[model samples]
Target: METTATIRGEIVTFLQNRSMTINQFARISGINSGTLSNILNGHRPMSMHQLDRITDGMGLEEGYFYDLYIPECIFHTTPDWRRLGPFLLRCAELGKLGCLHRAARMTLENISYAPMLFDMAEALFNEDKHEAAALLYESVAECEKFQYSERLALCQYRLFVIGLGENQDENLQAAVYFEPYIDRLDDMYQLDAYVKLINVNISLQRWDKIVALGKRMGHKAKIHYQQNRYRFRTYEYPRKSVIFYILYSYLIQASMHQEQGDYDNAFYYVSLYEHPDWINKPNEEELLIIEQFKDWAEANRYMYGLMSGQPNALNQYVDYVDSREDEIFLALCNIMIAANRYQLHIDHILDRYKEHLVFKTQQNQLGKISDLVTLNRYTRLLAELGIYYLNSKQFDRGLAYILDSLEYSIRTKSDNGMLRCMGIFEQFRHFSSEETQRRYTELIQDVQKLSVYAWSPQV
Candidate 1:
């Protein structure tokens, strides 16, 4: 919702902060003073060339001014889809979500452009420009009144998929948006929607809902498989889509049981996925997916074992997946194993994986990773590392990790994660030196002020 005037004002403030006058800035930027004054005073629009020169004059990075100027450009430009569409697409190609957001806000009153916006949104989504796509989709959804229109449904579905690994609230919103259209969707879309809803419920720890949905999905998959089997060749009854839904259902049930501390049921559900009959039934692609699911489920089972203090769980888990090459999965498994074993050698392990973790955390903050599950895992890993370092008496390093995690959690609007990090700070405060305690107390207060989510310890 920012305007050209706001951007110019920011530039003016930036120059003033550096104790530079507009004339000095214009001189250094190689721009005419009159033109600079006109642009600054809102009498003239700043060209990209002028903005770039000004950025250079201020010692800012390339594209710094361009990024700021994109909103102004889009806002002032006429609303012809033919002209605006390519410009928006170019911004997306350049990974400028801010520009897309600004354009969406600017075009909010122009519903006639919603179709073109939807197309551009899809293009952005296809290019993995999720935040940009989400912004446009949101605009489209608003224009469509979030009705059962195909575009609305598609927007809701994309938003749901994108939020799956990144934002629980977005996931919840997408789930609500898709609710009325679930029955009207085709089989594949319906199953996909159910899978996403189940994942969202899992992140929210809505166990009862997970169980209900899981059972329903299981039933649907069973019927789907049976009907297709009678109409098709051997092992082709359940297509890969149906197989995925069934596997995901099993995974959800396993997770739900694990959360409830029912390891037996958790193991039972995982066994269903690994059972010989189910294993022998999948097609090639389905088999690969099933194998991945098995590995993931096995990791969860091992995690449960470690949490429950079962003997040799860490060693068993290490021996099981020691050869795996998936960096994120291995990093997570290693951290959990180290934490469970009370290994104070967390510093070396963190040093080894910190960059990757930080990158993923940043991606989550930037809305690059839409999978809430993955985002949560990465956040939890950082928090656990923070806690481990604190327990190891490495206060500074621990605080750094905790603060980093807190920042990411806040950016993602993750109440659970923010509260967890805050709790860590509180616990650390009680055991720290006076100076450290004061710093931690201040941090705790800041976190409390920033946490807008309504959360209670009982919840």
Candidate 2:
């Protein structure tokens, strides 16, 4: 006779319809009879676990009771973090995103819940539960939108990182959205944020943005380093050593300048990172950072020389990169570019490192290389190879490599990469076979579809 449209009423109706007793339902649900009685009679709030059990006992899909439970158990009463926190976590664990979103939305009405939600989001993010954490981060950010708190900035930062993926456009958008919040974060966070921001922009080939951000990061890191040099605060530190940021800033500045074909300025910045003689007493970690930067500097020195058409630098660059597994792909890429530009014969060099020409993941002492960085380099590598072969009058190899790059470009939604591939293919259309032309046509259609997809409003 319970006519109310509530979870307990639904349970009552179900039991009556099946002619099942409370004890029978308890046995089926594996919940204690006494506990089940309290849950049904509204004497006690049901936990997510018990609700799931009851749902299963009712022969309903998992989370069948989540919608009712939210309004009835959570929204109808004062929100308690003790109960709400576990429920949200369980929802995440069960992949019940709709319920999690609803519960978070309801709970965040009180701005006091923002801190708790942020803390929960941090926990979820650390646990690598990114999708669930993103919901909480979005909710918390909305709740704290009017505030200029570091927590708000942190949320934006986390969202930026979580949002990064194969889609270059979305990654760029995420970076732009989060860039304004960088100054609001603490110094340590700013350093880490700049590095991540730079990495994404690098993937997108935004050299100008990288140079600007790198300068800011370098200034902030230098300030922090000067202030904290003698102080001993082991508890607080950046994601990397402070020295890493300083050197990385110089490295990126040099890289951007080099990309812009300013080899003189590039070499100037390169010298700054290569020499760390200013450090009074370098530790093991600091020494390691210095060594790494020195290696990078050496390779880059040769690259700058070779890129500026220094004939002797080519052999040195090849010799250096040949011994380093991590350096091989990028070195080969730049070498190919140089070879094409200078009309240098590097057929032997190509034959030597041909095995490493494909896209792959790599790990170093730092960690797994950024997928964004890897993908960007791989696409560019393919395009460069295509251009190299085409310029060498190897038409079939050239078209095949170009088409492969174009396909990857479409898959990753890299507009610049796609355009580069398309332009390169069009330049040598007369050399393309019928099959190659067909593939190119199909890839162009895919690009058109991708453009439409990007512009279409999400439902």
Candidate 3:
């Protein structure tokens, strides 16, 4: 019953070199002397906790024995979840991805372990250890690739969310990849998935895609709401209330229509979400959602009227949004777009909210949903302001705004935003000073470099 020679020999050598007794080492490592004796004699398996303490007592670097522990303690025999689970969790916490991958791959050799890995991945995901979680999720997903299971769909969904970031092109790819699996997900998740997909599409300014997704989301939400309204309603629900999705679907559709310049249709969809009287026995949560949407509808009505060239709409929209500080940023963005479109001057309005024009994320009831959408609108606002100033023949101010827009586009990796900025700068290049022109060239070069890097093949 000799211990695995490699790890045991290392420990023996360390003790010999330091003239340390087993009892001394045990005292230092906080392990019971008998347990250490058993571990050294191969009478007991070395748990991850014991291994960590042993490594520390030897004055070695953290996780120094992890690679050795895998074969000596884990893969040398059948992998036990009691040992493997805590081991993987420790790996995630310590950012020991190499060891995590090695252990995970060994355990996943049997597809029966997929569920265990998947559950651990979910735990890691909730703990915000995304990279480690992604490894498990990918491993589990690959194991279940040919199967049409809800777990597989959930893995894909997790991967989709993990993959999303500042890169617009990458976000679109993730959305497209996760789209088909949406139907395979349980009812609770599909609405949130649709909402996330729609947000990505909104950043890309894919109005048609948003419209299509919104319709599907609305339909699914309506069906679920009706089917479950009279039931006990004890089951787990989506992040938002059920009716929130339906109302959100309508709100998004109206916004998409507004973006497309179909003001009449936009107003029609706005009205659909405005009242929401069809909600059966509305709870406090549902009532809050309805109220929020109503406020949005009211503001949007002013936005639509202003965008469609109604003379009186500008003052009213400004007054409404001014009273609601949370709405100021997005409301001003819409106002600028309208002013640019209709050749209306908003100098007074801009001066009034000049302090609010900076890019800080505004919090809303629905987490993360408004952050990205607000960012997209803010970027567009920058470009619109540039255009407005240029049209007014304010060369320095106009180029300043344009440069800011280009910088933000580059930061966000928004290809569409970058292109728009490039086009706008090119249109006004003749009016730009030498300093502004040089800055523009530098930004364009950065864009080109990013483009090349994005298209480069991974080794």
* lDDT score of residue 128 within candidate 2: 96
lDDT of 1 by residue, 380-428 (tens): 7677767777777888777767766776686666778788887877676
For residues 323-348, write the lDDT of model 2, one tens digit per residue: 78888888988898898889888889
Q: C-alpha displacement of 347 in model 1, angstroms?
A: 8.4
Please give the TM-score that candidate 1 achieves against the real structure.
0.60
- Of the pair 1 and 2, which is ahead by lDDT? 2
What are the models' TM-scores?
Answer: 0.60, 0.95, 0.95
In order of listing, the candidates' clash counts read 8, 0, 0
Error of 3 at 79 (Å): 1.3
lDDT of each prediction vs. the true structure?
0.67, 0.88, 0.87
Residues 188-219 of candidate 3 have per-residue lDDT tens digits of 88998898889888888888889899899999
lDDT of 2 at 304: 97
TM-score of 2: 0.95
Pick by lDDT: 1 or 3, better one: 3
Name the regions of candidate 1 deviating beyond 4 angstroms.
1-152, 159-171, 229-240, 276-281, 297-301, 327-370, 389-401, 430-459
